[model samples]
Structure formats: structure tokens, C-alpha cells
Target: MLMTLLMIIFAVMVTALALTLVLLISGVHTFSTSFSPLSVSLASTLFGLGVGLLMFGGALLLFLISFEICKLIVKLITPSIR
Candidate 1:
């Protein structure tokens, strides 16, 4: 049950990462086209958001990995009474 929940969360994070990547690409394209104040601001905002999401995804992935490792260790150490 916990694994299933983690998988769902991972899926959502992947989707969000993809979306943020798209936004980052679009922002770069927009910046390349012109140098207006609004365009620059929008591009920067998109860049920041994309970077933030990427960082968050990395952290979540680490957390999931550690959780799984801990579960594995506990399983190995615990006696099989049943």
C-alpha cells in the first residue's frame, strides 16, 4: 500500500517535471525572440519555476530511495515469526 502511494506520487512528480521543462523551453524561445521587459520577466519566472521543480523532484526521489532502503534493511533484520 505504501509502495503504491509512492508510485502515484512519483508519477505526479514526473508529469509536473515534464510540464515545467516545457515551460522552460518556451521561456527560452520567447527570450530569444525579443528583449522586451515583459518577455524577460516572464522568461526568468519560468526558469526559476522550472529549476525549483527540478530540485524538488530530486529531493523527493532521494527520499523515496532512502525509504525503500530502510524498509529493505528492516525486513532483513526482523525475525520472521509468522
Candidate 2:
């Protein structure tokens, strides 16, 4: 039950993050075509932030994968308590 709940929560978080990334990319694209200096700066900042978020998400996924792998290894090495 706990694992199922955790999975559902993670799914929601990933979906939200994906949506935010899509929005940020679209915003950057839309702002990049404008002639105003402010728009240009806004676009650049958005691009930077989008890139940072991508990196962070990738790292988080990697960490989670590694953690799960470690857990599996430990489970295999140790006998079940119950």
C-alpha cells in the first residue's frame, strides 16, 4: 500500500514537471521572436531555467534508479525478516 501511494505521488510529480518544462520551452520560443530587449532577456532567462530544470530532473531520476537498484541488491543479499 505504501509503495503504491508513493508511486502515485511520483507519477504526479513527474507529470507536473513535464508540463512545466513544455510550458517553459514554449515561452522561450515565443519570447525569442520579439524585438523588445525585455522580451529577449526574459527568453534567455527562461531558457537557462528550463535547462537547469532538465538537468535537475535527470539527476533526480538517476539517483532514484540507483537507489532502487541498491535496495534490490540489499534485498537479495539479506534474508526476509518475516
Candidate 3:
């Protein structure tokens, strides 16, 4: 049951990461099209990209950690007959 919950959470995180990537890509296109000051536009674009990447990366890391921990728990719980 715990593993199932973790799997669901992992799925949600993956979905969020995909959405974030899409948003970041759209932002890049918007920045490219707008006629804004070079310095300001560059700063904002970098900041946005950095934040998006960080969120996606953090989610992925958490999902991986949860999966490993769950796998280890399952291994420990199940009886093995040699």
C-alpha cells in the first residue's frame, strides 16, 4: 500500500515536471519574440529557466529516492527461502 502511494506520487511529480518543461519552452519562445532590453530580458529569462529546472530536478530526485527506499523496504519485508 505504501509503495502504491509512492508510485502515485511519482507519477504526479513526473506530470508536473513535464508541464514545467513545456512552460519553460514557451517562455523561451516568448522572450525571443519580444522587443525588450537585452539585459533585463536576459536576466528574467535566466531566472525563469533556473527556477523551472530546479523544481523539475528536485521532483525527479525525490521520486528516485522514494522508489529506491520503497524497493528496499519490500526486499526486507518479503521472506526468502533458500
Q: Quick one: best TM-score, which candidate? A: 3
Instruction: List residue ranges in candidate 2 displaced over 4 A.
Output: 1-40, 80-82
On a 0 to 100 scale, what is the lDDT of residue 37 in model 2? 65
lDDT for 15 in candidate 2 is: 68
Residue clash pairs of candidate 2: none
Task: Compose the digit string of candidate 1's lDDT tens values, residues 1-82.
Answer: 5566557656755665576566556555554544445555866766655665565565556556655665665575455423
Sort the predicted structures by TM-score, highest score first: 3, 1, 2
Best by lDDT: 3
Residue 17 in candidate 1 has what lDDT?
A: 59
lDDT for model 1, please. Answer: 0.58
TM-score of 2: 0.45
Q: Model 2: per-residue lDDT, tens digit, 8-49?
A: 556765765676566556555554434346655866667656
Backbone clashes, candidate 1: 0
Per-model CA lDDT versus the true structure:
0.58, 0.58, 0.60
Instruction: Please provide, for model 3 over 6-82, each residue's C-alpha lDDT reduced to its tens digit, 9 standing for 90 to 100.
Output: 57656766766676566556655554544346646766767756665665566557556655665676576464422
User: Residue 78, candidate 3: how far off, in angstroms?
Assistant: 1.2
